[model samples]
Target: MYTSQQPAIAVDGQNRIHIVWSSYLPIGNALYNIFYRMRNSNGLWGPIETLSVFPNSYHNYNPRVAIDSEGNVHVVWEAYLANEYYPHIAHRVKTNRGWSEVVVLQSSYRRENPSCAVDKFNNLQVVVTTNEIGPSYDIVRFVRTPEGNWEGPDTVVHFNTGSRYFPEIVATPDGNLHLFRRDFGHYTNYCYRIYYKRYKILNYVILE
Candidate 1:
């Protein structure tokens, strides 16, 4: 009845487990849908809830999620619109009320490999890579402020032509941000290496 992949998990302050994954073949369509399930603090597992609200047609892929201090679950993924030429970052959140509607964070850029982290103050950071029609070998980052406005489309890193990929980020209790990503020689016989970078917020700027 269902097939799934790209599972992502996070645990909130209450130790409740949240799981998000992508599945396909709901009714013979070749596209995929993102689903979520959760085990509450009381140890009860909820039913499978579909996250991708494409209603008619679309493909949501490569999901990643993180939990904030308030036990809010935030998820980011790439949704390939039915007739659009590129994919964009899709986001959703689950609070005490319920899951919010899937929001398209960016549709102009062809982004993928979405990852997210929440700071001590619950500022959400989402990092993604552009694989088409963007800078060569670059990673882009977006931060949602505490007041609920999205702050950036920052090109956090660049390695020149097909080397930047798989960016993952996390925020510490002290508000410092850490990122890890892989760089491969996109056009040569070279080594694929994983690297880390640290950034701190100082006077309204991210000092790397």
Candidate 2:
């Protein structure tokens, strides 16, 4: 069982379970790292693996996981790159050999609260909030095509002139996408609502 402020879990067809979480360890002052654990089909959990061992002063959080049809595990999280003021999205994959190298998805944006899902075609869809510019926020999506290529500079899912945060996304059984986010209205000071929207991807067309 993994415990942290942010946690994510995914299961494969073989009943192999994977979990990722953020843990803060005090080296000199305080620092955090993303640790991972897995449960085999026999119900035995492997030892915790330190996925990121950054410096003791940096902060790491908001870990998410997704598993594809071939049983490859993908993980994404928010972390501060060396000599950077803002956090960026970092990704990794698990294979029969071992965990692959950490890949940085977005370097310029202050990204956080990332969640990922794999489509039926084994394409990876990731959604996260960014605060690279001003007070408002934007939701960005990255799709890894089945051809083993990462598509685009990240499509904008939602953009708000007002404040927005905490996005959750899921791929539906019907090949559609569902997204939920916290919305803060501008005029109605007393009205804060959570909004839900559905997106359909048919013939490679993303329809709202």
Instruction: Provide TM-scores for the models.
Output: 0.88, 0.85
Q: After superposition, how far is residue 68 of candidate 2 from its true place, in Å?
A: 0.5
Q: What residue pairs clash in candidate 1, if any at all?
A: none
Give the poorly placed runs of model 1, Cα more than 4 Å off. Answer: 27-30, 55-57, 131-135, 186-189, 202-204
Local accuracy of candidate 1 as per-residue lDDT tens digits, 102-181:
77865565788988998766788888888543555578788776555787777788755657788989888786889999
Most TM-score-accurate candidate? 1
**Model 2 C-alpha lDDT per residue in residues 1-208, reported as the tens digit of each score:** 3346677888889988999988875333336778899999999999988776534236678898988878888888887765578877777788788887776765676788888888766788888887664556767677876555666445555454665668888886688888887767673373777877888876345677
Worst 10 residues of 2 by lDDT: 152-161
Cα RMSD to native, each candidate? 2.6, 3.3
What is the lDDT for 57 in model 1? 38
lDDT of each: 0.78, 0.74
